[model samples]
Target: MTGNARLDLAIFDAVDIDTVGAFYAGLTGWDIVRKDGERFGLRTPEGQEIEFQRAPDHVPPRWPGQEFPQQFHLDLETDDPQAQVERAIRLGATRLADGPAWITMADPAGHPFDLCQADGVGPVMRLFAVTVDAPDASELARFYADLTGMRLVHDHPEGALITDGERNLMFQRVDDYNPPRWPDPAYPQQAHLDLVVDDLVTAQARALELGARRLSAGGERYRVFTDPADHPFCLVW
Candidate 1:
């Protein structure tokens, strides 16, 4: 393992950038740390960075459906799951489901997330895991484990979770999953990940060797590649 890569940012595409940015900032109590004409961003207190890009005519995904399946979802940990759910509703989240351990909610932009119960009170929300939908969870998990040098932390029949020291990523099997086509408006990549590397050439070579296909060269500083499951991720130096 190179051990030289780290997750730099998670980018979301939203139809209304300001509204989505405000929703997340209010929900996480994070300030807008970066902003430009087309993008907005926030850095959580725990150092996780997220950015939103404006996508004109974007159609929010309909989770658990064939129309536009949710390619990914974030899991947030809360000491008081119910209370957190209530607060999120006040911040424009719609509760989709509630249970003893986890509560599902959709954000203002219709991205699904889970408020999972935790042992103690901490930040209003903590970035727990970014879960991706795949036809073969085991295969995707192994591919990322090799690419990021993260260890497999949790294994289930239909899913698996992996973690580097700083970030956690999960993969879950989705029935009849419809993968997004890059730069396709009808089936857009709702969100994507950015990984920072010290040497882009070395990282790109290793990624191709480990089963990633080059989709586009974003620029001298960034390049886009798709994982085995067709999810796009950028390797940046």
Candidate 2:
């Protein structure tokens, strides 16, 4: 929390928890470590975890929609993009498009993810980055860099990337992006990050200094706040 904060989770809010959990577990060969009626969690071989929570009345975001946009997307790394795309399709993912360096696809719950070809990184599918949509990529990246003390690796008009060595976070420029209304299902939070910190009060103060707006002060070990781009994230001890 003081020196380097770790990303604990990349969570998705899905209509069917089991379906989404199964899709990611099969897609990544990760173990579904936690499962209940309301929540399903997967622990990757590398120890990374992604979870999906039940939202019966969830309305999936429409891609390229200004009204209800995809707030974020997961970037998966693979040595063979084509084979991974095929495998994803077999596991209930819908191929959206294939870019020159990445293939865009949606999971069973209609959340978009990218399968990017890696340069001899590994054959196993791995979560590379969690890209968040923002009004200004560079600005958002700077905010996170200050908050986490991470380096700003990439800076561009289209997008900007930041990393804390262990995890990568990207910010993509989105025109007329609408910030999600916290606790309001109308503007649902499609995805969110859980950052681990040491002290709540000290970390919260540092976060606010870095432009994080406190949304809620609930829970004994966690608090909810919105980033400069209005993406909700939790600071947990």
Candidate 3:
């Protein structure tokens, strides 16, 4: 892909687009940029976009388990995690787990995300990272780092982190990791990514060489592919 693919959008599947979009909008204070019968889109203050697609048969992931795995999740940072956790609960989130400096919660659509305590001054709530579950964190991190040209800031056996200065993509080792079977609602891809590229053909070829499998489903303007870990991502122009 010439290592120039830009991670454009992070997308999640939801049965009720409006409810899921409203929940995240209330939690993050992001503006709802687009909403239609088929999809909903929200934009972060930094201009990063998160989209929800209509999936009537969408199946929610089962976090902390491999049977119906949570393939990906967002990590949100805030100065006061406790208050944010409360606010999120009031906004229709259910507390999943708690830690000293972080709290895990499931959104209305059953997507698991974290409210982590941040050290520096910033927005009340900001997206800190988008973490993906993988059998080998280092391997997945390396694949993305090579594809997107994101700098690998941290590399370990258990986990890995990569950033493009503005956005962070993390990978964590999951025990008995179960990859999604896309195009199959029973084993739905709870979330996926959209990578923007200047040339679709070139990017698709390079991505295939980097262990991405091109999927049969795609539109003329975009093509779908799965990463090394079977996480569905798109190459869009």
Candidate 4:
């Protein structure tokens, strides 16, 4: 199937944009492309952008638990996990867990991410995937696959993966996932995805037909909608 939208940006809500933005920039070696009083944007070597928006009253997620669940986390591939972990720690990341193949750490804003050991000799580090939590990984994966027209690369009961070769989107099974209530600061959306489309009207209609719920929040150039799993995403023209 053809993709209705192209993944453009991944945005995170942080209490302090400077701290969070600087931490990610130091870790990923990405340059700050856009910076303002309340918002900061960093662009990867490949031009993929990760933005952080200031949310003074942002409520951080509690990972490894259902209470204030983490809506999403980034997986970064690194050649030397130990070195990267050390660097991350120095950059204000707190070590959360350790595994043979991956090391989990929480960023300055309390978002958990993994420093996964890469297989071959490549760049020192690169973004591996953007993973979201769901009650049913298989079902959510299918929904995103159909919505983004990405190929399902891995499917299992616990997790699922969809990719367009370079970039990947993953779904992990959470026992009791607590979705975000957007437009409500009490239960904030920690992070969200922005998808670009050629035609906003057609794309919004298609998204709604594919089990997406229209949200009341949006602007002229874009419209907001929540996926089947209730994570906020935008269709931008």
State which candidate has the highest lDDT: 3
Give each prediction's root-mean-square deviation over alpha carbons. 1.7, 1.9, 1.4, 1.6
Compute the lDDT of residue 84 as modeled in candidate 3: 85
lDDT of 1: 0.84
Tens-digit per-residue lDDT, 1-237, candidate 3? 345598888899999999999999888888899999988998877777889999899888767788888899999888888888888899999999998888999999999999998877365468888999999999999998888888999999699999988888999999888888888876789989999988888888889989999999899889999999999999998
Local distance difference test scores for all models: 0.84, 0.84, 0.88, 0.85
Q: Candidate 2's C-alpha lDDT?
A: 0.84
Task: Please identify model 2 stretches exceeding 4 Å from their true place.
Answer: 1-4, 121-123
Which one wins by TM-score: 1 or 4?
Answer: 4
lDDT of 4 by residue, 1-237 (tens): 354687888899899999999998889887899889888998876666789989888888777777787789988888889888889999999999998899999999999999999876365357888888888898888887877788899999699999877568899998877888887777689899998888888888788888899999889999999988888999888
- What would you estimate as the lDDT of candidate 4? 0.85
Clashes of each: 0, 0, 0, 0
Candidate 4, clashing residue pairs?
none
What local lDDT score does residue 169 receive in model 4, on the 0 to 100 scale?
Answer: 88
The TM-score measured for candidate 1 stands at 0.93
